[model samples]
Target chain A: MASKTSSDITVIQPPRGWSFPNLREVWDARAILLNFVQRNFNVTYRQTIGGPIYAVYTPFMTMIGYTLLLGVLFGAQEGLSVPYPLFSFCALLVWTLFTNVTQNATTSLTQNTNLIQKIYIPRLVFPLIETCMQLLTFAIAFVVLLLMMVVYAQPFLWQIVWVVFYVAVALVFSLGFGLLFAGFQARFRDMSYLVQTINRLLFFVTPVVYDSTLLPAPFNTLYIYNPMALVIEGMRWAMLNVGEQPALIPTLSAVGVSVALLLVALLVFQRLEPTVADVL
Target chain B: MKPENAIEIDNVSKVYYVAESVTEARGRARVLRNLTSPLRRLRATLAGQSAFGAEIPVKALDEVSFEVPQGKILGLIGKNGSGKSTLLKILSRITAPSSGQVRIRGKVGSLLEVGTGFHQELTGRENIYMNGAVLGMTRADINRHFDDIIGFAGVGAFLDTPVKRYSSGMRVRLAFAVSAFFEPEVLLIDEVLSVGDAEFQKRSLGKISDVSRDGRTVVIVSHNLSAILSHCDLVAWLNKGKLASVGNTAQITSEYLLSSTFESDTLAGEKRFRDFVPSDKYPFELLAMRTYDDQQHVRSSFLNGMPVVVELEFKLGAPKWCTTTPSVRCIGCVGLSRPICSIRDRITSTRSCKFTAKMC
Candidate 1:
């Protein structure tokens, strides 16, 4: 055994801030993060009478609501040659995935305050995994949508592959928004209430409940700036063949904002990362 | 040279500013007005401020520095609010110090409370894994040692039960099991062994002793002098967050005990402590008590085997019999919980008599 001096031992001065700057350390801690995410995923529906059935129940309820409220009451606002039930179902699927994913991701760290305070892990991983877990639930809902479309005898063309692109767009939008708000909420805390209120108002503003194209000109162009608008509109076009292709400008603008928001959120979160523990 | 001193705390100081309640500082008129109504204080507190926010600076730790030589156990002893827990938290990385530096040599496992890292919703079996991982154990390693952990906790029957369902004693048992089962380079414990039944406490101490024997450094923060004396090799006596003394356990403990006893003398004994043992003869007679060193010089401190003197001041003629022997029991010499020892001496005095004897 080699004799050692006090200087030889590395004293980990209490790390400041939230970011795990050490790539090697973060990489080594992957198993721990994975385990934490798995534990949360299990806990969400574990031992409930409904069990994993809620994964089915959530989107099924949304689909039923959309059929009655939008399809029958409003008479299919998008004016697609497609049936009202299929059109409304497609919009509900995309909207549920985006909204639920963002809500769960942004608030994951705040809700698990005890674990965050006691232990140190890659803080970013919490929001990221939260996004993933909710997406897994969304995927279940997506499968239900596919089965419904098949039952209605909608043609399964190669164009159905376009659904993946729409899902990707929604996820990118959520991560961008979720990360920005997660960091903001950690500081101000009031942002959580604001986000919830906005999420409620967002339903009417977006193309989910009623198609945005039904709104008169100028307003439709303006509303597309809301990224979820382009995502939901694109989903309707691709999945239910509704409201034409929605023009390239709106789709391009959605992609631009998602990318820009993601960059800014990552930068801001990294900057405010340290001293999170002290503040919380 | 001995394993590079597992813990080296250099110039670490933690400062907490003490604050006073607003009610205490308010004027006489305000105090009376507040006493007449409780709703106003609640309203004031709800307005995002409180009287307790008024700053009164208290130095919880002041430039305290020490090291636990690798494989050596160190005891931290102090009075209430003397900065023992603050120092331990800084060393264990539970919280950051206001200033200064700390260097830890190896994987440091700390148990500052009975269940500092337990997840209440998790089952006993699951928490063992979660806690082990937090303390730096890999999954495969925990899996390999799972049986050993279950056996040590002795909670095999309830391993699948949620930790919230476990009694406090059961929680400590499982907590100690998970912590003790893991082999880390250094262990930091803070008064957790005081939990659980006496038999389990003994087992926990034995486990700690085994860890010490295995050449892993251990630093224990405790107010129990006997526990420290019996377990630790070196001790640092903290006073007002500074090191008052540091040396072998025997020397530091004896010094601490003597200082405490002297401090206790100034306190007017409590009315509840007024001894009135009705006897056949003279009920009870007060005595002049003086402790001395082995050299027979009048000294305030009596080390182990030194002499203690109890001089009595009494009146001889009374209705009760005068043949009763006076018994003296001095608690808190070792600690407040246990008596050091009791001394019985024959009492015969016209006015008063000074009783001098040796302390074992």
Candidate 2:
């Protein structure tokens, strides 16, 4: 043998009817998580003519379609003087990141049926890796949005750096929702579709296409407390310096709510992990 | 748990929910059932009954209890669905037991599949590290054994080629090589030896022996009796969902093979063969068994997919009324269940119907 093995004892017992997340184990197994991340990245563009080049242009192309549909068909309406294309692109970029992250998270466990059923890595690794992939895609889309800012002759706001914070909030909340549903999707095959439909409906509720500040009072009220609506509007404020500057009270509370939701979702994920393996 | 015991499983049981009511419903009906399940469950709970028994609880493993000593190989033998796989799954933490506990003394690595996480787009070298990492090997451990893994797999020439381009044999060899080098303190192997070519099996058995010699404990679940008999110091037999017996390998395994009601379902033989305890109901026992090649030379291993003749020597003294099954046409001795028959394409038969038998 080339090396001496570590002698760590493990005790396996019946689940105690509640599951508390094993954060230490998840941290210790980070290398396996990296390998999973590598596998996903390596396979993402296989057999495609453009390869990972699509990562750069796919979001750009989708932006084009949105620009025509939303920017051209529906002109800029009281958007505080920013070009329609730039405003919508900023919102669309954040929205896409949320949907992509949530969609992948919702199906992560069910997609790797072979790995989950045969091997014993922390199941949390799947959704976590997916979140990483979505974040990487979000970075690429942010770069594209920056290039658009130059084309529209938009001012380079130092506040643009805060876009990262909005991305974090979107990701954290989407991950929480995705993880909670991914666990369910393992047992109920209908859950993936349900999550996708919910995502579609969520887009309209979120201030992705239209300005929440310009909406009537009852609807503009969404910007105050809803984490997702706060995220989209916050991204717009950070990118275009639009709408009431997303007050510190709302921003801090939004972050607090999203983080709390993630913690609860993680707990639910741990509780459902064992039963999910059986169904998958 | 004793200091010498590497694993102590106390009354472990794994339960599964078989959703019959949901499964029986057609497409739209299935969706409807899924939608109304919570309400139905509520109604049933109010009535102190079940929600149409949709999920029938199955004890795949029922109160199975056993111990494996350090530096030894313990074999788990059981019929199909007798909970062998379920027990291994519990030990490996792939699934949790419904009740009871299992305490293992050291780090555990399970080889349930040969190449569980191998990506087709990845090269052989990349897969080596990835598979090793997935199986709980640290990056340093993989680096130390990298050269050995390559040499063992004999795929140095194609190390950089994507696994998809490799021949099927090459893939199997590469997959086996990574698993063979996995050095956990306690190893749980479940019939993974039945994979790959014959020479690969030899290397697998050798690796297993190497692991045992290193003072690590191994718990193997396999239907290959000869492999188990040659390697295991102790054996546990599971009948139905419970542990039937555990003791000396030679004794428990032979009793397990002869006593198990495995092929009895198809056989018209006497009901005595179905006895959970062969010694309790009948005096019949398997004396010795061996495998022979076409040249009639005794051998411990056979080539992959090749026809091999297995000879079984059994004691026979059943009552005249306990007639043997007609399907079994023995060439020698008064009647028993053994038949001097032929079974080709015996890819993975736990119990073959055709074998030569002699009454001693």
Candidate 3:
């Protein structure tokens, strides 16, 4: 109905499909996203006794416990070439990053109800900002991984660069589920519990604490399709060379699944975006 | 030159679904909710029903439309639940309307909240940048107005101090100052002038009027008629989610003020059901209402200083719940944003099992 054709004129309407927030607009608001990431990173550790060092504490302590039980007590180290702590610690760091980032991403929209209801920043930007916060933690924890590698005299493998690839896949996989569950969580506030329970079950299946090759024959073949297993096995192969190397077909298939989940989750997010302000 | 009109709102409407619980436990809904909650919800979801209850769809805004001409100050006035805020929210794109079209020229900035996303731990300086970005201002824009914002908030000495240490007045002023620097072509203001001290309120009004004079269209929703009358060139009256009237400030405002009284019995052939405000805090529903003079004749208009009795009838939801006393205090006087009086409680008709509150 607007008679003007100047670029300055904007027409607002009852939204059709076009109302789904565009990526370009989200990119244009990158300043706001940076602010969100910076604020969370700065404020989250301010009142803590150990500050941001808490990021590395979880993976380190859990590795010690796993080494005592699985290596020293159970002789679980017999099947591995590298020390149990190094192998499990590498797996734990990747798994920890995924879980921490995923949990924050899942609850991002519900947690910032104030900002969503008042400010006009894109709703999709929140999950991205929250996911970015976990990266700082990963950066801090990666330093510890290097220190432990020096302690055990594990030679720095050129394949160690593949750790970055596995981390990227891990992040993408976590973000996919995070976006998927966030939509459900908005309507049903208890949906986060369901998400955490699923993650706990997945923790066992992904071989975070145990070696992947220990699985029964039929289950070993089926494990190739699991995205988390892909991340953990790929990280173990690249960093420690302690497990069966990730095969090409399985790695490609798992990455494809991660990308597919993200696309599907985006559709779900678009469907629920309009109702967000009302429900919250 | 810019477009003739900065905004074109076409038949805009918004609908909200308000869920109402079907069966609440007698005076102890909390206990029941705590026990059988998740299982009941899962069953309800499986059966395609809401566990809480059925949702009643409410038409928050009907098909009403009005345009703000370029450089004009438009005031949206209505009582609570009249869709004034809904319209503002739609304009700001905080929520999409259910149906209709709104054409706006240039950028749109909404002052829907003061200091939106303000971090308690961040310093006043950091908050200025963060809050500015939250309001859709770019980094360059905040930098351009950095000193002005500090001067306006009067927090120059404490710019590096944490906001948690600032006094409440300082915090509000700081927030208002950041929002006041936003330079969108079409600005939506929703009751933000009521924040801060009286001095800050006056300063905000001045900044808004100054924005209008600079060829920016401003839409302000406020209960303060005096502020609206003094600043607005146009006034729009919304009644029951519909536009009742809109025109020059003097005419529309006067017409709206006369018709908005709760007890307007004199308007013949009009059944204003919205005159009865829904009490969500209590289960009781208002059945009917009547006003009476000292002569025992029905009346809504009264001479100056003459006291009248307002008899309210409500249908009690639970008989046993009437054991507790309920009080009603009429909020906000005619066209004024202050409580004039809480009428004296004269009677409680418990024999009929219907609670009645009478006030002076």
Candidate 4:
């Protein structure tokens, strides 16, 4: 008979502060991530009648709210010969992505908190899924927003090409900000309330309900400090060819801010990742 | 190749900081000011609050390490807060440790709760794929095992019914079947068998045993001490988030059970069959009875048909009562509160009386 070895009884531990994920090791669990995202999308719709229909229709309702509140109620001028519905629809397209992604990301760690504490997957995956799911919603809403713009704006503006570029930037910005807030919310908890408040405040600060022409030169420069302002403005310019072209300097500054925030968010999230299970 | 160990958790430790108070202010001034408020701090401290609700770091697991060899079943025994679930979660990759690393050799499937990933709106069939997907099974793999999984769950009648409509027992059975069939290299099961009826429990256990025999590793966390002891070949005892002992199942379980001081109950009863002659009016006999351990040792101390000796002391009243035999009755095995027993032999004495009997 052969003798048993100690490895037969004892588990081996990994090195201290191991940060880099062996991609292949993580990749093997790709089915889990895909299933989770699919489940979330399916669940979100299954709870309602014509679920994907609602996802598509809700953006139009939001556009009506913006049309009434910003276009008719507050009388924010719609320039570049774009109809209020077309312009507001464009803003809604981008803003919904930002808001939905942020909300999903912020609550990702907290709501599925039990799952977070019980299993170990890359923590980043939860928020990333939220972003991707909302992107699907964004894509559905974008088609309607584009059709309205072409139908009402009197001509097909190839300027709609810029929508893709703006969407990419918006996504990166959302991920960056979403990560920062999600990490903070995991710890402080007060960040949950703060995130909602910030979202409301940001609606006014960004051109979501209005045009960038409402702002003067230096303030437009100051607007870049709020990265979403450039994103919203760029989105409008690209989708409706509305208002002033966002200056290159401010655009570059916005890009720079987004990159910095993304790096910082990753670092902060990683540094705090180890504590998340404990805190939660 | 000889199968590698399924899981290797080395020196895993997790530390949690409990906030004393909900209020935490940013910067140095808040800290200094809070220090001066002794009364507030005292009140908060008494209430288990920290300045910023003071952070008291608790070590959930401290330098704990263990392994489950391939195809072997390991039982994790621990008191409440012993970090057994925490250890399982780390191995399952649900939570990260504060320090240390865990490397699992193969695909890990976990059933931390009976319905850990079930969606209420999705029907039984839909959730099968959803849960399968969550457990790292590709759709095609799930398709391959689809009939086996559904057949094992025995929910064919309600296959299209939303899971919310299924009874809790049905849900547990289906969820457990899904987990069992996923066929990962390592399976982490946490107290899932406690959910269902005895027949279901037996089914689930049989499934788990089959998984182990198929050259996969299993780590089980259960409060059913006897179940764990009987099923596990290797047992690890955890106390207060630390490893109390680890080795052979018998040695560890006995040590774990005996180390605790069990309280004894004074009022206990036993059952007996006796023939007693009635004095004047009536004559009857006692049929059956039982004695209960007051210290909650009923299961721990007694097994079916085990002989137990009992001693009884009493004061005799009168000779007239001597004709009646003392008899005892045992009752309340299923749902009755107290066991009823009769004494067979009657005693007549002025002083203290002692009688010894063996309980059947």
Candidate 5:
């Protein structure tokens, strides 16, 4: 042990306005970040028989439901370039990632009320852990999507590398909304229900079940502004060479909007972080 | 600001704005309030009225200021809801003070509650690492002391088992061991040590002493008087969100004990004479009485073989000479009441008289 010497002093007081979190302190606490992620992963599948296989199974079941509801019932596959299951499953991949990440992240602080009250770790870590945990599930579901694509013999295009960029967009978009809802959820609790309602509404607005081409001109133009629409459509255009490929200008604008939303989300989250424990 | 001081708390206060209706509001009212409060505030804002609504503000800490010198063990003694935990929370940076500030030198390890973030599904080893990380220990640091922690907790045999399987005592021991090894420059401990078996408590206390002796600062908040008396170099007493006293451990502990005894005495008196109504025609009236053990501590029940003392108080109507006799009645397990003993005393003119009787 080192000898007692008062070299560095940490001054604490009530937060007044927006202050950036100590990123260096967070970096130094990488072990805690990893532990949180690991704990969430472990606890999610603790007593389950299927364990992590359920991650893939959930999306697989959802894909079947969407295919039946949107593809067969509505005959929504008339305008798609690939099989209905492949296109819809591709959209479901991004949609599931967005919904799961945002939902988990929104409730992260409230769900860990015991830890929040008892200890001081960077509050951002909770949302980040939730995002990463959902990302892990998305990775598994992505593998399942690839298997389905092979089974359908959908031609894999060279543009598949662009899928990484779309995935990044989806991650940022989800985290941005997650942080926003989390700040309100910490105090309000009703924000979670609001988020769920919005997510359900968002599924219809985005090009998840039906192709964007099925929509009229102005609606098609406006739908890409939702960010997830562009991401899901771009992902399908890249991997399956199906769906209308969003123009470069609109895609770039959506990415810019997502990044801007992420910045705002971070600022709002930081402003609310200090008082989260008090409210809880 | 002094280099020798490890913590400088400057007039720090914490205030919580609580909704008074939260507890009493029924399901529909709660849902309505939750749904429409924001819209109402927005409407009020648009109408140029202040959006802040009515909320009851409770001050948990009131401008409390104290400093802990480097390498000293300071015990914070207070009753429940007396701001001891609030002060510790401010120090740990879990919750910020509403006003003023707290300055601490170097890293802080706060064990506000044992097994704070322990997930029941995780194995003991995993929880140790997770908890150690939460308490601000690096992975390498935990790795270095991993075996020592398991050995100290005596949970090495069950290291791979989930924490939910362990008894509560074993869980507390493991949690304490992980926190004790954190080795931060400043340590804040709440009443976590009061849990677990006596042997573990002793070892945990010894570990605390070892930490302080190694030239680190430790601030401990506990209700256990003996533990505070034995382990602390300085004692700070908090009463109702304010610092009541601060001094040497021995002196402060004795004063705190004396005050607490008086408080409990009054409390017991109130309970004993709650239904006693004084008559306007009497020259004197009995006020209150209670039993006490030999150690100056109040006792509500006495063992059959033990000697007991009964103390009583009476208010005199006028300052006239009076002879008062006090009698005791033993109530058996059945409905029968039997006369036990009686004591007689003659007193000169006085406004009040207090006397004690020893019963064999």
Candidate 6:
């Protein structure tokens, strides 16, 4: 039998204003994070016959639709040296990653109410796990994109390494929004529907299906400020070398804004963490 | 600062702000009242009273404080809505108290419900990892105890099957096995032991005792007084979010039973004659009858496998030349009562008789 000894003491009290999450506790629970990611990855396509193929199929079908509607029917320029299918597919990959991460992370807290009420783990792990799962899907989709690029005979520039940087920006950007919305969604259920509306409207404003140059001056300038647009366009610029070179100042500003939003989201999420179980 | 104290709670209180629905103002008089309500509200506000239509603040716990020494099992008992679960949630850090503080030593693992983080789509093997992780066990720890957990749960055959296909009992078994074997220094278990069959419950209780005897602290929140009396070294009783009493298991439980209306009248030996009317033909009266457990504690309810000792304390008006036998009847809800068993006593010439029946 082990002797009675107090190795450490955990002091808990009501949070006031903002509380910093105990990152060490989260680090200690890395196994739980891995399990959450694995469960999500498996359950996403558990009963489906296609299994992981659906990850590639979704963007493939969307790319075909955009090529027919925007490329041929609407006479929209591909805005890149690569074919319209490859061009729009690259943008679709980044857009899908952002949207999936944001929507899933936003609802992760509400979806895991049973776990939240019954156990004690780092609450931030849910959002982090959701983001990581979406990242895994993005990785799978990236493989499909690589295959498509090879078939299209698109030039693989040395700048392809920069795709990693753009993808990181996209992940941070969506995760920031996810944390913000998840905090509010835990309090007001209407925020879920509101996020859906905002995301739908954001799609039209983002340069996902069409290049930002297609829009007139003010709208194009305003659209450039959207962090996701910078990510999608930057990925295209790095991979295809077809789109205009991203302005250094604007891209750096987007990164700064994403980092700031992430900090704010973290603070808000930590403040609301203690009360989330009660509200749920 | 004492190394022996595992948990210390000081002046903890929780207040909930609940919204109140405003009824619709109807008809002429209601409209007039609604129109003038602002004036009344202003007057009340000037008089230092809360305005009507404000959110109601409910106090779930009020300045409750207690401490538990290491390596002891403490049982918390209370009626419904007495804030026992809230206190447990606070201790588990699921939610923070509205005021005051809680300090806990060592790694705290809480099992508020069975299969808390189990995903329905995941197989039993996968769920074991998920639930174990949720309970604060690392992947390596779970891997090391993998065979032991599967053996304990007896779900090895269904380990590869999805949890949704498993029966509820199997799920609970797997859940309890993982939690019990995780072996946290301080384990907070809610009423999860009440889920399974009699044998499972017995084994679960046995496992809890094993954990207790292993020199770890366990806090159990349960309504089953017998389980508490048998398992807990110390008991705390809560009434309406307030600490009613805390002491030795038997003392607090007995006091709680005595103060509450849950006690049986026969146990107190009060108004035994009123249980049944005396027949003029028989010239005999029933004095008192009650059931008790093996510990000699009077219990009005019993689990399926427990031994029951029924005692009949009665007065015989006339010591006639007839043998007196005490029989027990099984009554069904369909209003059918049949004599299932009886205990025959030798003929006695005494006015008072006491018959005891032991049924295992």
Tens digit of lDDT per residue, candidate 2, span A103-211?
Answer: 8998999899988878899899899999988787777778878888888888888887887788888888889888878876776577789888998998777777676
RMSD of 5: 8.3
- Worst lDDT window (10 residues) for model 1 chain B? B267-276
- The sequence of per-residue lDDT tens digits that candidate 5 reaches over residues A197-219 is 99999998998888787789789
What's candidate 1's i-RMS value? Answer: 6.3
Candidate 2 CAPRI-style tier: acceptable
Instruction: Compose the digit string of candidate 4's lDDT tens values, residues A1-280.
Output: 1112223232224223324433464475567777777787888888576768777676688878877887888776434467788777777778888888877788788877867765556677778778888898888777776567557654656776877777887888888888877865665576678778888898888877666667787875586567788887887777666776678888788788888877777766665565566555
Please report, as a residue range, the 10-residue window in candidate 2 chain B with the lowest summed lDDT.
Answer: B266-275
lDDT of 1 by residue, B26-95 (tens): 7455657755664654343323223233445567788877777788889999898888887876776545
- Over A46-134, each residue of candidate 3 has an lDDT whose tens digit, in order, gives 77889888879899999999999998999888878898999899889988888877787889889988888886787889889978888
Q: What is the lDDT for B209 in model 3?
A: 89
Q: Give me the overall lDDT of model 2.
A: 0.77
- Residue B123 accuracy (lDDT) in model 1: 88
Q: Provide the overall lDDT of each model, using Cα atoms, as 2-decimal numbers.
A: 0.69, 0.77, 0.79, 0.69, 0.81, 0.80
TM-score of each: 0.77, 0.81, 0.80, 0.76, 0.82, 0.84
lDDT of 5 at A192: 91
Cα displacement (Å) at residue B310, model 2: 20
lDDT measured at residue A41 in model 5 versus the true structure, 0 to 100: 83
Q: Positional deviation of B79 in candidate 4, in angstroms?
A: 2.6
TM-score of the candidate numbered 2? 0.81
Best by TM-score: 6
**Candidates 1 and 5: which is better by TM-score?**
5
Between candidates 1 and 5, which one is better according to DockQ?
5
The list of candidate 3 runs beyond 4 A from truth reads A1-6, A15-20, B25-53, B262-360
Model 3: share of native contacts present?
A: 0.63
Best by DockQ: 5
Q: Which CAPRI level is candidate 6?
A: acceptable
